[model samples]
Target: MTVYRIPAAYLHQIEQELDSDEKETMLFLCQDLVPDLPVPDVRKLLLALNAREMLTPVSLSELLYRMKRFDLLKKVLGIGRAAVEANLATCPQMVSKYRVLMTEINEDLDKDDLTSLVFLLMNDLGMSHVKMAKDKSFLSVITDLEKLDLVSPNRLDLLESCFLNIHRKDLAKKIQKYNWEAPVHPIGSSLKYVNTLQASFPKLSLADPPGIVNKGRLKNGACNFQTEQLRMAIPETGGALGQVSNKYRMQSQPLGVCLIIDCIGNDAGMVARTFKALRFEVRCHLFLNVDSMMRELYEVARLRQHKNYDCFVCVLVSRGDHQGIFCTDHIIPGFSLERLKSFFIGDRCPDLLGKPKLFFIQNYIEASNHQETPSLVEADGGLCTIPQVADILWSQSKVDASTLDRSPNSSSYYLTTLSELLMDPHKRTLPLLDILVELNHKVYEWNRTNPAEPHSLLLEHTLRKKLFLSGT
Candidate 1:
């Protein structure tokens, strides 16, 4: 369970500043007071506002004043020194509208306690706090925070999704349409602090890795009795790292992640759906193309999820005129195989308990009679004693620099064969090894007859046992 770390005080500051009510008021003023403001200009204003502890009176005044200063007001509602110089008569109507809106809202909230007032607002909007409490629902947690004048829709999206999963579509709709009225972008908000804060968003980890520390090292007190403290920059433990136990296999239903990076062609969605239909919880990421940096991001993201899944699957569909594949941008060589696979190895990722890790790469190479040089079987570069997480690698073409036949509609041979094999009623319940063996046999026969356009299933299975499916 490795995760990104951030300061707790900084997070607390963000929570205190951007209360839901404050956000809603700002959005409304921008809509009603300064109508037709450019999206970017509005975003900039919202970001600038986030940095201040702005109360209703001051927030409304500053927003309007800035709109006038920034020259963002509509043609008819223009004002200030620039407006006067441009012959657009200073329209005091916008300022008057802002004052009236703020006065009305303040007067209304002043009539009752803020907590009770917001609870009633939720009811008026069809959210029953009582009903959510009856179900022990977490939405109650949200409304409780609302009473404290704090809420962020960015963090609430997860709770809303949970509600939707339980068939609470009514609540889901509320969250989805929750304009909170402000358009605060996380990545490039006009607020510099917010942009900086985004980089520190803490990962919701199950727990931290036990031996790892925030900073510094742990040393015996007896080493320096005079100095009661030991200060070290980074801990350098002098021992081999412990990997997740290989004997502790996951017995649950299989789950997987699918990555389809296609720069040249399409139809990966069809492949992804086929895997999803097999009941594996599938996550599909599509890129018009991928570079080395994008590829690194995928590996990091998958490593984080290693502890939660039974098996991990990745499908890399890219251009293959080169050795590895062309990521619409980079010429990723086949030599990067270990670099890609090393992310899941014992030394690198211990969270992936010795279950099965699979990779299916869909890239077509030119058909040739050229034979590749064989690897020298040195004892030093051989197998491991402890059987780690098994790896299953599948390639579209044979290793002899041969071209393969692919279906125009289906797109790739590996996917076509895999989908067909999974759908076979007789083969569905068979162990995965048997299925793959049959696939190899069938493909060999296909190439033996259709020599002109030969396509083979090149499998290098280091998996110790059957990764069999129970079948649909």
Candidate 2:
């Protein structure tokens, strides 16, 4: 028997019929089912769902019926609203009740209603949230609320109350109805909510991709060696100490040395170009074993060539766990990040003293049951102590190892978004700390749209002043 496939032309026709708002709404409704997809791409989304066998002709008709696209249901699929209603008991609803309720609420909110809602919740939300609500769409804000656990299937009082305050009792009724109506479970449904139960974060896989590098051939690893490191030489403007009194002093030409250590070879070049464009001398090394990694890091920390530079930046991409990042050999317990930081400390590397040392770690955390051991700090009887971890900012993200396996050449969501934000000309003057906050916001948006693959940013810093990478 010949297998059925969704025609590209059919999908294109359906896509052409959808407006921007409809496309966005459809994407939100399908997020839990087919995630990590580009937004507002109706055709692509339908194709993906069809490819996954999660959407049959019957289910597709039901989806359009729920979206109230009855015209398309009849014209495209030859299914009438009556047939859809009759088969409602047999068809599994792909869109969750929680998401549908939120989307309905969003549809009822006009610009003034959204403005009033944000105004009413000003004290309740954070400073960043206020900015987000003002800058982003109302649907985006709803996604943020869901991420913060402020809204969920079992919770609607906050939303209903907000609607009431805005004089939208009709909108509030939708929420009340959702709560009052008891959900019916579709018995023996073939398309299970499998993705819902999947890990929120991508788990780092142990096996390396073929042709990238050989785990045993440490000596034969590939490296994108820079013969003459490109540096941007812009004259210093402000005082020797940056223009801002509280900001970190960044007046040096060739702002810093950015070392890109990519275990997976896909996104190194993209990352290298981003930092290099930001006026930093960039160098990249790939597929190094444990020994080679240590040697390269040691050389970077103690190198005299970077003595006059303003800061030190390292971007390490590899598979890691709670303990640390893995080498090409796929070791059980990888290299400790603390030990990596130790190499850049003032005690070990004086060349970087008083200068900001930033590390952007893209680690694919392995999925396992490994537990972290607690450490006890013992006093050495010293009356006073200075923190050795000062002037260093660590920005790390852990993704599932399966991400790489699914698309070997694809970059992780975190790194791809980070590079894009860093390359923005408008953000060049912004402090690195603020840029990171923006990165978190971008990731939040990504997770909101792509529920399948969620990337989290974990930032830890010991810097005493804001570090500006550009406009020095």
Candidate 3:
């Protein structure tokens, strides 16, 4: 016993409406029918037929033949000549074999068939492949099919996959041409100034004096005597001059000493020796760790009085690796601007905006091969006989002797040990601050006489002006 499905009461209602001779109702029902629908209720009703028993092949064929004649199937399926041609090109079996065998009788397709085709292309094949196909005609067909709601959700993933496979260079060019959105955070303006400084002073070569060693002890324990020796030799060595004297006198009073040690490890000893040589009464702090140094600096600055030791003479003992200083600035645990200020300038000093506290860094003071003559001319308006003076000016100016005639009183000196020491791989020396102090004193004495000729009349006038200005 086989059970058969019926079209139900709605189909009967539809049939009665169609048989009333309503042309529009008949046309709509005729176009709505398909090969898949076995029973035609309206036709069966009009013929007084037992639709279930009339399942014979001939009967079904005649019914479909009449339906096709009204052009109802073609209008309902919306299968035009162009659509049929496109379907035939990609899928010949739909019309050539399946349609003929599946249908009870040959029939023209309605809009339903076209709608089904569109849905099939969209859900089954995926849109990305259709878009990528070499045939433009297929793409146009797909575009039309999409209007009927054919494409599926998985099409987006297929499109992304296609884009990812593009050549790297092509992708890069496309990216370059594209306008990029600005980043949220831009670099600070201070970095530009720092970069300019780095560009201007690409390489700064400094020198250290000879006979100064890293041996924890000086051969002679006599600090005053050693200081005198440094002082005495400075003039003869071209370290003394009027310009040098004026420069030192103009520098603001020191706040504190900044100890910058290099990789050589003996900078502590160097600092101790230099401080002793200069007769500066201050305790030297040795920092193996950056945190301790920062803490000490702050603590000392916090003290209300006696903040004269604010100048830091960073003695970089090692050669070539300057990055350590940057690392120290970043990692040092305790650093305060207040401490730096108190240390460099005493509490009595006015805070001048944008003035960097003076720092005198001394390193690599070995004698150099370069030599220059002093530009010191005699009071009689003739050049001095000191060959070292000439050598100094020569070394400093890098100009030929012809240029020396312009500034007669200009005395210059090249470090005696600088040329050779710079080439030497192994050797430790004194801090630059000590050398500068010694040089300053020597220049003061030299300028008191000879080319500078410190006049009593000028001194008296200067003293009078200072006293008058102070209202004393």
Task: List lDDT for all candidates, in order.
Answer: 0.42, 0.68, 0.27
Could you tell me the C-alpha RMSD of candidate 3 in Å?
37.3
Write candidate 3's Cα lDDT for 1-472 as tens digits: 4422333443343344333323222222232122234553455432332343322222222232333322322433333444444443452121112112112111222344324333335533567744443233322333333343331111111121222233222322222122121111111111111100110111111133422322111122111112111121222111233323211111223333434443223344544454333333344554333334433443443343333332223222221111112113343221221122233222212221111232222222112343423223122121211111110111111112221244433322212222223222232133222333344444344545644232110000001000100001
**Candidate with best lDDT:** 2
Runs in model 2 with CA error above 4 Å? 1-244, 370-388
**Any residue pairs clashing in model 2, and if so which?**
202-399, 202-400, 203-400, 203-401, 204-401, 205-401
Report how far off residue 427 is in candidate 2 (Å).
0.9
Q: Which of the two candidates, 1 or 2, achieves a greater TM-score against the reference?
A: 2
Candidate 2 to native Cα RMSD, angstroms: 23.0
C-alpha root-mean-square deviation, candidate 1? 17.8
What is candidate 3's TM-score against the reference?
A: 0.20
Kindly provide the TM-score of model 1 when superposed on the true structure, using C-alpha atoms.
0.40
lDDT of 2 by residue, 380-444 (tens): 21211222355877777766677787788888777888888888887878888888888877776
List the RMSD of every prediction in angstroms: 17.8, 23.0, 37.3
